[model samples]
Target: MPTQNQSLLDALNACVAACEHCATACLQEDDVKMMVGCIRLDRDCADICALTARFVARDSAHAQHLLKECAEICKACGDECEKHGAHMQHCQECAVACRRCEEACRAGLAA
Candidate 1:
Protein backbone atom coordinates (compact mmCIF):
# COMPACT_ATOMS: atom_id res chain seq x y z
CA MET A 1 0.00 0.00 0.00
CA PRO A 2 1.03 3.64 -0.43
CA THR A 3 2.71 5.43 2.44
CA GLN A 4 -0.18 7.89 2.70
CA ASN A 5 -2.69 5.09 3.07
CA GLN A 6 -0.53 3.26 5.56
CA SER A 7 -0.08 6.38 7.65
CA LEU A 8 -3.79 7.03 7.64
CA LEU A 9 -4.44 3.47 8.73
CA ASP A 10 -1.98 3.81 11.58
CA ALA A 11 -3.58 7.07 12.65
CA LEU A 12 -7.00 5.50 12.60
CA ASN A 13 -5.82 2.61 14.75
CA ALA A 14 -4.25 5.00 17.24
CA CYS A 15 -7.37 7.07 17.37
CA VAL A 16 -9.46 3.94 17.96
CA ALA A 17 -7.36 3.02 20.97
CA ALA A 18 -7.30 6.56 22.29
CA CYS A 19 -11.03 7.07 21.96
CA GLU A 20 -11.78 3.71 23.56
CA HIS A 21 -9.54 4.49 26.49
CA CYS A 22 -10.88 7.99 26.83
CA ALA A 23 -14.47 6.85 26.87
CA THR A 24 -13.80 4.26 29.56
CA ALA A 25 -11.87 6.78 31.62
CA CYS A 26 -14.63 9.34 31.28
CA LEU A 27 -17.12 6.87 32.71
CA GLN A 28 -14.91 6.46 35.75
CA GLU A 29 -14.53 10.17 36.33
CA ASP A 30 -16.19 11.83 39.32
CA ASP A 31 -18.26 14.04 37.05
CA VAL A 32 -19.37 11.39 34.59
CA LYS A 33 -22.47 13.40 33.62
CA MET A 34 -20.33 16.26 32.40
CA MET A 35 -18.25 13.85 30.33
CA VAL A 36 -21.19 12.16 28.66
CA GLY A 37 -20.86 14.03 25.40
CA CYS A 38 -17.17 13.40 25.26
CA ILE A 39 -17.65 9.73 25.98
CA ARG A 40 -20.32 9.37 23.31
CA LEU A 41 -18.28 11.10 20.68
CA ASP A 42 -15.24 9.04 21.65
CA ARG A 43 -17.10 5.77 21.09
CA ASP A 44 -18.55 6.99 17.82
CA CYS A 45 -15.17 8.15 16.60
CA ALA A 46 -13.55 4.83 17.52
CA ASP A 47 -16.11 2.80 15.57
CA ILE A 48 -15.82 4.96 12.47
CA CYS A 49 -12.04 5.01 12.65
CA ALA A 50 -11.97 1.23 12.79
CA LEU A 51 -14.30 0.90 9.81
CA THR A 52 -12.36 3.49 7.82
CA ALA A 53 -9.12 1.71 8.52
CA ARG A 54 -10.55 -1.52 7.23
CA PHE A 55 -11.85 0.14 4.08
CA VAL A 56 -8.44 1.64 3.41
CA ALA A 57 -6.60 -1.56 4.18
CA ARG A 58 -8.69 -3.43 1.63
CA ASP A 59 -8.16 -0.70 -0.99
CA SER A 60 -11.91 -0.47 -1.37
CA ALA A 61 -13.50 2.00 -3.77
CA HIS A 62 -15.47 3.36 -0.85
CA ALA A 63 -12.29 4.23 1.07
CA GLN A 64 -12.32 7.85 0.01
CA HIS A 65 -15.90 8.37 1.12
CA LEU A 66 -15.20 6.65 4.43
CA LEU A 67 -12.08 8.73 4.92
CA LYS A 68 -14.02 11.93 4.41
CA GLU A 69 -16.61 10.85 6.94
CA CYS A 70 -13.89 9.70 9.34
CA ALA A 71 -12.19 13.07 9.11
CA GLU A 72 -15.39 14.83 10.04
CA ILE A 73 -16.00 12.52 13.00
CA CYS A 74 -12.41 12.87 14.17
CA LYS A 75 -12.69 16.65 14.14
CA ALA A 76 -15.93 16.52 16.08
CA CYS A 77 -14.45 14.14 18.62
CA GLY A 78 -11.34 16.27 18.93
CA ASP A 79 -13.45 19.34 19.58
CA GLU A 80 -15.43 17.59 22.28
CA CYS A 81 -12.33 16.10 23.93
CA GLU A 82 -10.54 19.43 23.89
CA LYS A 83 -13.18 20.89 26.16
CA HIS A 84 -12.04 18.60 28.97
CA GLY A 85 -8.40 18.26 27.98
CA ALA A 86 -7.03 20.54 30.66
CA HIS A 87 -8.72 18.58 33.42
CA MET A 88 -8.40 15.07 32.07
CA GLN A 89 -5.20 13.50 30.76
CA HIS A 90 -7.15 10.92 28.75
CA CYS A 91 -9.16 13.64 27.04
CA GLN A 92 -6.00 15.55 26.22
CA GLU A 93 -4.43 12.42 24.75
CA CYS A 94 -7.61 11.54 22.85
CA ALA A 95 -7.89 15.05 21.38
CA VAL A 96 -4.36 14.89 20.06
CA ALA A 97 -4.94 11.45 18.54
CA CYS A 98 -8.22 12.60 16.95
CA ARG A 99 -6.50 15.60 15.36
CA ARG A 100 -3.75 13.38 13.99
CA CYS A 101 -6.29 10.92 12.64
CA GLU A 102 -8.31 13.73 11.05
CA GLU A 103 -5.25 15.05 9.27
CA ALA A 104 -4.27 11.59 8.11
CA CYS A 105 -7.76 10.85 6.79
CA ARG A 106 -7.83 14.15 4.90
CA ALA A 107 -4.42 13.47 3.45
CA GLY A 108 -5.48 9.98 2.40
CA LEU A 109 -8.59 11.33 0.69
CA ALA A 110 -6.53 14.00 -1.09
CA ALA A 111 -4.09 11.38 -2.28
Candidate 2:
Protein backbone atom coordinates (compact mmCIF):
# COMPACT_ATOMS: atom_id res chain seq x y z
CA MET A 1 0.00 0.00 0.00
CA PRO A 2 1.15 3.54 -0.67
CA THR A 3 2.06 5.59 2.37
CA GLN A 4 0.34 8.87 3.20
CA ASN A 5 2.39 12.03 3.22
CA GLN A 6 2.92 13.58 6.63
CA SER A 7 1.99 17.11 5.59
CA LEU A 8 -1.44 16.13 4.34
CA LEU A 9 -2.09 13.98 7.35
CA ASP A 10 -1.15 16.79 9.72
CA ALA A 11 -3.44 19.26 8.00
CA LEU A 12 -6.35 16.85 7.95
CA ASN A 13 -5.84 16.05 11.59
CA ALA A 14 -5.76 19.74 12.41
CA CYS A 15 -9.04 20.29 10.57
CA VAL A 16 -10.69 17.48 12.51
CA ALA A 17 -9.48 18.83 15.83
CA ALA A 18 -10.48 22.39 15.04
CA CYS A 19 -13.93 21.38 13.86
CA GLU A 20 -14.53 19.36 17.00
CA HIS A 21 -13.35 22.20 19.20
CA CYS A 22 -15.49 24.73 17.34
CA ALA A 23 -18.59 22.61 17.79
CA THR A 24 -18.01 22.26 21.51
CA ALA A 25 -17.41 25.98 21.87
CA CYS A 26 -20.57 26.84 19.98
CA LEU A 27 -22.53 24.65 22.35
CA GLN A 28 -21.18 26.59 25.28
CA GLU A 29 -22.08 30.03 23.93
CA ASP A 30 -24.64 32.11 25.90
CA ASP A 31 -27.08 31.97 22.98
CA VAL A 32 -26.22 28.42 22.12
CA LYS A 33 -29.44 28.00 20.20
CA MET A 34 -28.45 30.78 17.87
CA MET A 35 -25.27 28.89 17.09
CA VAL A 36 -27.15 25.82 15.94
CA GLY A 37 -26.16 26.30 12.32
CA CYS A 38 -22.53 26.76 13.18
CA ILE A 39 -22.49 23.70 15.42
CA ARG A 40 -24.26 21.62 12.81
CA LEU A 41 -21.82 22.59 10.12
CA ASP A 42 -18.92 22.09 12.48
CA ARG A 43 -19.98 18.56 13.30
CA ASP A 44 -20.59 17.77 9.66
CA CYS A 45 -17.28 19.24 8.62
CA ALA A 46 -15.51 17.31 11.39
CA ASP A 47 -16.97 14.04 10.20
CA ILE A 48 -16.03 14.80 6.61
CA CYS A 49 -12.49 15.79 7.56
CA ALA A 50 -12.05 12.77 9.79
CA LEU A 51 -13.35 10.35 7.17
CA THR A 52 -11.44 12.04 4.37
CA ALA A 53 -8.25 11.95 6.42
CA ARG A 54 -8.65 8.26 7.05
CA PHE A 55 -9.23 7.64 3.35
CA VAL A 56 -6.20 9.65 2.33
CA ALA A 57 -4.03 8.24 5.09
CA ARG A 58 -4.72 4.79 3.82
CA ASP A 59 -3.99 5.87 0.24
CA SER A 60 -7.06 4.01 -0.75
CA ALA A 61 -8.47 3.94 -4.27
CA HIS A 62 -10.99 6.55 -3.20
CA ALA A 63 -8.47 8.99 -1.74
CA GLN A 64 -8.82 11.42 -4.60
CA HIS A 65 -12.56 11.56 -4.32
CA LEU A 66 -12.44 11.90 -0.56
CA LEU A 67 -9.81 14.60 -0.81
CA LYS A 68 -11.97 16.56 -3.23
CA GLU A 69 -14.92 16.44 -0.89
CA CYS A 70 -12.67 17.31 2.00
CA ALA A 71 -11.46 20.43 0.26
CA GLU A 72 -15.01 21.55 -0.51
CA ILE A 73 -16.19 20.92 3.02
CA CYS A 74 -13.19 22.69 4.46
CA LYS A 75 -13.92 25.73 2.34
CA ALA A 76 -17.52 25.76 3.48
CA CYS A 77 -16.59 25.22 7.10
CA GLY A 78 -13.98 27.92 6.93
CA ASP A 79 -16.43 30.40 5.44
CA GLU A 80 -19.03 29.60 8.05
CA CYS A 81 -16.49 29.85 10.88
CA GLU A 82 -15.17 33.13 9.54
CA LYS A 83 -18.60 34.69 9.96
CA HIS A 84 -18.21 34.44 13.73
CA GLY A 85 -14.47 34.92 13.88
CA ALA A 86 -14.67 38.45 15.22
CA HIS A 87 -16.90 37.44 18.11
CA MET A 88 -15.35 34.08 18.88
CA GLN A 89 -11.67 33.28 18.96
CA HIS A 90 -12.41 29.61 18.54
CA CYS A 91 -14.20 30.35 15.28
CA GLN A 92 -11.26 32.37 14.08
CA GLU A 93 -8.84 29.61 14.96
CA CYS A 94 -10.99 26.98 13.32
CA ALA A 95 -11.31 29.08 10.18
CA VAL A 96 -7.55 29.32 9.96
CA ALA A 97 -7.16 25.61 10.49
CA CYS A 98 -9.82 24.76 7.94
CA ARG A 99 -8.29 27.03 5.34
CA ARG A 100 -4.90 25.43 5.89
CA CYS A 101 -6.37 21.97 5.66
CA GLU A 102 -8.22 22.89 2.50
CA GLU A 103 -5.00 23.95 0.86
CA ALA A 104 -3.25 20.84 2.04
CA CYS A 105 -6.02 18.62 0.79
CA ARG A 106 -5.81 20.19 -2.65
CA ALA A 107 -2.06 19.83 -2.65
CA GLY A 108 -2.36 16.21 -1.66
CA LEU A 109 -4.72 15.63 -4.55
CA ALA A 110 -2.32 17.24 -7.00
CA ALA A 111 0.52 15.18 -5.59
Best by TM-score: 1
- The clash count of every prediction, one per candidate, is 0, 0
> Please, what is the whole-model Cα lDDT of each candidate in the order they appear?
0.95, 0.88
lDDT of 1 by residue, 9-87 (tens): 8999999999999999999999999999999999999999999999999999999999999999999999999999998
Q: How well is each residue in 1-111 modelled by candidate 2, as lDDT tens digits?
A: 334467888888888899999999999999998888888888888898889878877768998998898899899999999999999999999999999999998988898
- Which portions of model 1 miss their true places by more than 4 Å? none
TM-score, cand. 1 vs. native: 0.98
Model 2 residue 75 CA deviation in Å: 0.5
- Candidate 1, 21: how far from true, in Å? 0.3
